[model samples]
Target: MSEVQFACSTEETHQVGKPQAPSFTGPFTTEGGLTAITLSSPSEMDQWIGEWIELAQQTEFCNAFYEPTFFQAAVKNLASQEDWQVVLIKEDAEDKLIGFFPFVRGRGPARLSELSLWKSKLSFLTSPLIRSGSEQQVFKLLLKHLRTMQPRVDLVELPMTLAEGRVHQELHRLIRDNLLTTYHYDHYSRAILTEGHDYDELLTENIGRHHFREYRRQLRRMNNLGQVEFRTNEDPEYGECWADWFLELELKSWKGEGGSALKQDPQQEEFFRELVTSRTRAGGVEMLGMFLDGEPVAMLCTLVSQKGCFEYKIAFDQEYKKYSPGMLVQLHKMQRFLESKRSPWVDSCAVPNHPMINRLWSERRSIEHMVVSLGRPWANIVLGAMPLLRSLKRTFRKPKR
Candidate 1:
């Protein structure tokens, strides 16, 4: 731990019972002469985290998973002790913070660890939380520092970063122009939407109006079974209740039976509860539900940050499968987004060519498992095998219907 003071928007706060890292204040110099600090404890920046998130949101490259709340959840429920590290990319000439990157080093494909950005299997759409315009510069310095830094990191592994995002794009460019030792692990597509003038207009332009009309007709028929109603939690007071409803609803679906639902996993459930509770107060979480005669039938959980909204989980009663309650709720949710204009965009984190969301969100955002191996002796082994592994994965995937 190092000792230093930062001129941040919020003064440091120490919360009892909350996890705390030893006070560490060390000045690290980037090869470019930029100042930064790396801390093992996330609590070190608790006071400044809120302001950091606010600033990150202003940039076009904000990632919800890299937010402090997400990191806190990961540290408490997902990661074991000594698995994660927070590196603060300091502002060039000031005591303030410019960017924050939280990375967890783990073994790569070759059973060797050079990759530090691999946190857990839970995080999707991975990327460093770098200052928007400094992605290239920061990595250059960090990679250089890694060569001599106490814990030798061999590579920065970002497995599922959106191809179009500035983080991925800039890093890709670094490989191209700077001759960095980077490798392409895999490339795949996902559904993403860029909100346009009106939701109606976008729907009409994307999914034909006639087809959308048919979905509405199906919903009207579902009304015959019961009084179909769509609802979302807009009040923090009802967050716990809504979360309970969602978890219970999820239990009635295949996910629970298969032991994959959040409630089925104690750690994951706690992670969601703790993180979503905070996000709800910050207006960054939404619990959308569909009801039948006042009874919950289906629900969708969404997490929002300044960057965009991500549809985290969707669940519905299998008894209402014929009514397509889940898909119906999905449409209603999109309609609500259109009406409320709450988010500028939404990411349906579905796999490529998903049966439902892919058709709805016509806009495609490609994502890839990208690895930048350090120029170490064994690094080339991981780099060389990535393309072959990607091909095998593609070959084994179920063919699109």
Candidate 2:
């Protein structure tokens, strides 16, 4: 609401029903004169997305959710009253953008405030946007400033972020000097692309030629079932055919029975619609479908980001599981993707040890759930007890037979 606060922004009232832009009044400072701007609204950071992407190009970690289109869509679709900050960190010298950390400030135990990256369940990667080499300095600036926030903030949680990425390493490096006690919870597994090999060759080498041969056999059998075909929607002009088919296909799966399908979740459906419709014409969304006699059997959707195309959500008709329709369609598209070399990689966006993706991709992207104590006594207790609680649960679940 203040028109002249913060350091890296110029606040202007847009009255779009969300918190107004935070002003960059050059007040929030850290070591080396680094300053920050936190805007409660996503629109306020629209102007900086180009710079954000430019910086991301030089880093090993990138989550497509940081893209302006995707970020705005998620916040608009998913309402998290307490969780959303379009943070920009920069140097006071030339006032250049050095870091972009879009997060949801969290409410933790004992009323301590928290800075967290993974906001919605839809967010697969929780990495911050910062150049590769400047990671340490940027983290220092952030932690130092966070130390001084009013009402006393504590606890920094980065859920579903890469454990092997630069951000995690930098956080550990800073813990030695800062008043931060950190803990890593190995929560999820992710699959990554392997380079320098053809998709077919990789499949043969990893899944084995016998399995590949069986897949081919299944494809032939499916052809006999009908006019089998694999289709992709990428042209900006293409309408919502892909989404309609995908929803229908997904509804027939277990997710639909469990009431987790897109149509069942209003927020998810809204987010998916905007993400696909807004980017379809720009080649920013890719939809792949597998069909038998024009009947949808499987479908995969992805959001194209600066780093690469990321698998958003996928589904298959369980009735056609005998033909492995989902795997077949994904394989066909992957072969083309390999040949196209679109963005140098494809993130499976699948959970680690995922029975499907891990076996197919043969590469791992390390991810972890983490927490940092912001020097608060309550935060320290929460962080200290979390692991113990998990351990107790694990022990209680052990079979005694």
Candidate 3:
């Protein structure tokens, strides 16, 4: 924990009706003779936010798959719905924005006497737009800034996705060196296109395979019960109808057996609805559906961004499981993805070790994990006890069948 200092300028009195404004003070000193400043106003933060994002995008580690705008929009959406803080870090020497960390107050009884906060939406995997300089120095500065606010935050859980990157690796190293308590959780799925040299060639290759013959045979069998057809929103006249059909099909599919995909939870539904509505306006949302007798049997919701189409979600009618409607729907979606001008790869986010994603997609990607702590002896003791605690908890649970 650090000390809190109150500083006041003549302007500060007008803003908060106080002679002084409270600011957290910490012991971590800046490198390169840089000073730390926190921006409290959103407009102030936005002033140099664009430049900060540009720096991150220009970094060698940047991936087009995670667009800056998407993250910015997501952060804004979360902040608008709740009381949260968005912090911006800049170099005092040049006043250059170096990092952005969005976080909110932690809700629950405080086990410790410290106020707690968490990264907004477990945003560890999403890098704070950092400039291309000494990453280690910048990261150290960022952690120092976080420590200053330790009185307001207890545990920092960053659910970093696709962790096999240098930035994440370095972060883990720092955390371990400092002896912080950290846990790694398996987050999402990644899949690669196994059938093509390029997008068009891959579609052609898939269609020419013996599996395509079997697909057609199954389609013929499904059609006998009614009419089996693949529908997409590429056409203007059919676009809105297809979108609605996709949503309905997703609700009725296996996902619906437990609960409707989007409608399963109100919050998830809200997130998807907002995502689809907003992204569709930008010509990003691509909805695909498999219809039987004009009723959708399976549906997939995807987003085309940069050079890839993301298979965001997919579901199929449980009754049509024997007919493999889910597989049929994916084949149709992949075919459309290959033919589109978007990009050459389709990202099948994350799936369990199921036959669909594991057996079908040959390309593989690894997600990494790291633990961070504040280099305290007590912190190390608590972290050390976690594995033993987990083992004891597991011992008490009944074995699964």
For 1-401, candidate 2 gives per-residue lDDT tens digits of 12234443433434467443334433265567766666666666666666655665666656677766677788788756754565678765644577887767768645668777745668777677787778888987777666765545688777777677677788788987765676677666578784467777899988999999999999999989889887788566664666677877888987998989987887888787777777787677888888788888988887775567788888999898888888888788778778877676778887667897787787776777877897777778788887788899998996979
> Relative to the true structure, how large is the alpha-carbon lDDT of every model?
0.72, 0.74, 0.56
- Model 1, 1-401: lDDT tens digits are 22343333222453576433223464354545465666656667675665566556755655677777776776789776665556776654433455676666676667766546645546666766676677777766665555555556667777777788677677677667655566766788888776654767777777798977877788988888878778888888887788788888888998988989889888888887887788888787888899999889999988886568888889998888877888888877787777766677888878788988877788877788767776776776767777788889999999999
- RMSD, one per candidate, in order: 5.3, 4.9, 7.0
Q: What ranges in model 1 sit over 4 Å off? A: 1-23, 31-33, 109-111, 197-211, 385-401
- The superposed Cα distance between candidate 3 and the true structure at residue 394, in angstroms, equals 2.5
Per-residue error for 314 in candidate 3, Å, reads: 1.0
Candidate achieving higher TM-score, 1 or 2? 2
Q: Comparing 1 and 2 by lDDT, which wins?
A: 2
Candidate 3 regions with alpha-carbon error over 4 angstroms: 1-83, 90-98, 105-137, 150-154, 176-212, 220-231, 234-243, 291-295, 307-309, 338-341, 368-371, 396-401
- Residue 74 of model 3: what lDDT? 50
Q: Give TM per candidate.
A: 0.84, 0.86, 0.69
State the displacement of the C-alpha of residue 378, model 2, in Å, after optimal TM-score superposition. Answer: 4.7
| Per-residue lDDT value at 252 in model 3 | 73
Error of 3 at 104 (Å): 3.4
